[model samples]
Target: MLRTYKFRIEPTKEQREKINETLMYCRWLYNALLEQRITAYKRCGVSLTFYSQKKELPTLKKVCEEYKSVHSQVLQNVVERLDKTYQAFFRRLKQGEK
Candidate 1:
């Protein structure tokens, strides 16, 4: 059997601000990682993998203090999502889907 539950709650003003900040950081990281992958492939014909980019999180945190505010797992999840997107895109391309 499968089951699901849902609940909703209001966040305090400070909590809301913190959540928004984390989201902004995630968005920034996603865009930066995407650009890095595209540039690497264009310049050197190398495709960046999720594990490769995930390994850079610690160094990124060291260079950008803002990323430290976001949880490591959350950032890894962002990388994973992008990788999945790329995989699906290529799969569809191989299947001749427009």
Candidate 2:
């Protein structure tokens, strides 16, 4: 059988600072990837896939200090979440929602 559990705990001042910083990095990465995808499609008629964005992380970390503090898997998950959002958007388009 599979199970799940949830808990809430308070963070220390330093930990809270790190957590806030990580959240900001994640938000920035998501927005940047989304913009890349949009611009690629608009200018080149191509939509960027998750793997393409994921591959860019290493290079991004080298140039962007904000990404260096965040873990690799956390950044990968952000790319995946944005991909899911794009997929849902196209699905809605197919359904004639807008």
Candidate 3:
């Protein structure tokens, strides 16, 4: 047996602004990471794994101050999501689902 619950509430104006900012940062990071992986593969014939990307977080934070504001767990989740997407895409390709 299992149960689930969901709740929604109106956020304050500042909270809304902060939420938007966080989303913007996450979107930027996702795109940047994707680009990095693509470029690495195209130039070096290598695939960047999640762990390798995750290890760069500290350096990224140092280079981009805005990223520091976003929680580490949230940043890691973004990487994890991208990795999962890549895995699923490859899996489908392997199955010859063109």
lDDT of 2: 0.94
Candidate 2: tens digits of C-alpha lDDT, residues 23-64: 998998899899999999999999899999999999999998
- 33: Cα error in model 3, Å: 0.6
TM-scores for candidates 1 onward, in order: 0.93, 0.90, 0.92
Candidate 3: deviation at residue 15, Å?
Answer: 0.5
lDDT of candidate 3 over 23-64, digit per residue (tens): 999999999999999999999999999999999998998998
Candidate 1 lDDT over residue span 2-48, tens digit each = 99999998999999999999999999999999999999999999999
User: Cα lDDT of all candidates, in order?
Assistant: 0.95, 0.94, 0.95
| Model 1 worst lDDT window (10 residues) | 61-70
Instruction: Give the TM-score ranking, best first.
Output: 1, 3, 2
- What number of backbone clashes does candidate 3 have, counting pairs of residues 3 or more apart or in separate chains? 0
Superposition error at 42 for model 3 (Å): 0.4
Instruction: Return whichever of 1 and 3 wins on TM-score.
Output: 1
What TM-score would you give candidate 3 relative to the actual structure? 0.92
